[model samples]
Target: MDVNFSKQGDWTIIAVEGRMDTVSAPEFEKMVQERILQGSNRLIVDFSKLDYISSAGLRSILVAGKNSKAKGGELACCGLQGVVKKVFDVSGFHKLLPIFDSKEDVLNRE
Candidate 1:
C-alpha cells in the first residue's frame, strides 16, 4: 500500500492506494498514529485508490479513529467502493465512522 498525506483546511487527508493487507497495515497504522500524535486531530482517510483491505487494515482504521477521538478530534473516511466498501459495511464500520462518497463530498459537507 502507498500512503500520501495532504491538508485541506483543518483536516489532514490520508490518501491510500493499492492493497491494505497484513503486510501493509502496520505501516499505515504507524503513519496515522504519528500524524495524530503530531497534533493532526481532524483526519480524512481516502480509500479511493485502494483495491483491497484486510482485517488488519480495518484494525488500523479503528485505532486511528479511537486515537483521534481521544484527542478531541474526529476521523472520517472517503472514497470507499467495491470490496473495501463491502468490508466496511459488513464489519459495521460504515456506522462506526463517517463515510463520504468522495473527497469533494466530504469537503462540501464542511
Candidate 2:
C-alpha cells in the first residue's frame, strides 16, 4: 500500500492506495501516530484508490479514530466501496466512525 499526505486548513488528509493488509497496516498506523504527535488532530482518510483492507487495517483505523477523539478532534473516512465498504459495514464500523461519500463531503461537514 502507498500512503500520501496533504492538508487543507487544519485537516490532515491521508490518501491511501493499494491493499491495506497486515503488512501495510502497521506502516499506516505509524504514519497516523506520527502525524498526531506533530499536533494534527483533524484527519480525513481517503480510500478512493484502496482495493482491499484486512482486519489489521481496520484495527489501525480504529486506533487513529480513537486518538483523534481523545484529542478533541475528528477522524472521517471517504470513498469506501465494494469489499472494503462491506467489511466496514459488517464490522459495525460504519456506526463507530463517520463516513462520507466523498472527500468534499467530509470537508464540508459541520
Candidate 3:
C-alpha cells in the first residue's frame, strides 16, 4: 500500500492506495502513530483509492482511532467503496468509526 499525507485546515488527511494487508498494516499504523505523536490528532483517512484491506489493516485503523481519542482529538474515514466498505460494514467498524461519503462530508460535519 501507498500512503500520502496532506492537510486541510486543522485536519491531517491520509490518502491510502493499493492494498492494506498484513505486510502494509504496520507501516500504516506507524505512520498514523507518528502523525499523532507530532500532534496531528484530527485525522481523516481517505480510502477512495484503496482496493483491499485485511483484518490487520482494520486493527491498525482501530489503533489510530483509539490513539486519537486518547489525545482528545478524532479520527475519521472517507471515500470508502468496494471491498473496503464491505469489510468495515461487516466488521461493525462502520459504526465504530465516523465514516463519510467524502472528505467534504467529514470536514463539514466535524
Candidate 4:
C-alpha cells in the first residue's frame, strides 16, 4: 500500500491506496504515527483508492483513532465503497468512527 499525505487547515488528510494487509499495515501505521508525533490532531483518512484491508489494517486504524481521540482531536474515514465498505461494516467501524459518504460530506461536517 501507498500513502499520500496533505493538509487542509488543521486536518491531516491521508490518501491510502492499494491493499492494506499484514505486510502493508506497518507502513500505514508508521505514517499515522509520524503524524501523531508531529502533534497533528485532526486526521482524515481517505480510503477512496483503497481496494482491500485486512484485520491488521483495522488494528492500525483502531490505534490511530484511539490516539487521535485521546489527544482531543478527531479521526474520520471517508470515501469507502464495495467490499472495503463491507469490511468496515462487518467490523463495526461504522459505529465506532465517523464514516462519511464523501470528502465533501466530511469537510462540510467540520
Candidate 2 is scored at a TM of: 0.97
The residue-by-residue lDDT of candidate 2 on 1-110, one tens digit each, is 99999999899999999999999999999999899988998999999999999999999999999998899888999999999999999999999999999999988875
TM-scores of the candidates are 0.97, 0.97, 0.98, 0.96
lDDT of 1 by residue, 1-110 (tens): 88999999989999999999999999999999999999999999999999999999999999999999999999999999999999999999999999998888877895
CA lDDT of each prediction against the hidden true structure: 0.95, 0.94, 0.96, 0.90
Question: How good is model 1 by TM-score?
Answer: 0.97
Best by lDDT: 3
- Ordered from best to worst lDDT, the candidate numbers read 3, 1, 2, 4
Candidate 3 positional error at 14, Å:
0.5
lDDT of 4 by residue, 4-92 (tens): 98988888998999899999998889889889888997999999999999999999999999988888998999989888899999999
Q: What is the lDDT of candidate 1?
A: 0.95
Q: Candidate 2: where are CA atoms >4 Å away? A: none
Measure candidate 2: CA RMSD.
Answer: 0.7
Task: Give per-residue CA lDDT, model 3, range 28-103, as digits (tens).
Answer: 9999999999999999999999999999999999999999999999999999999999999999999999899999
Native RMSD of candidate 3 (Å)? 0.7
- lDDT value, residue 12 of candidate 3: 97
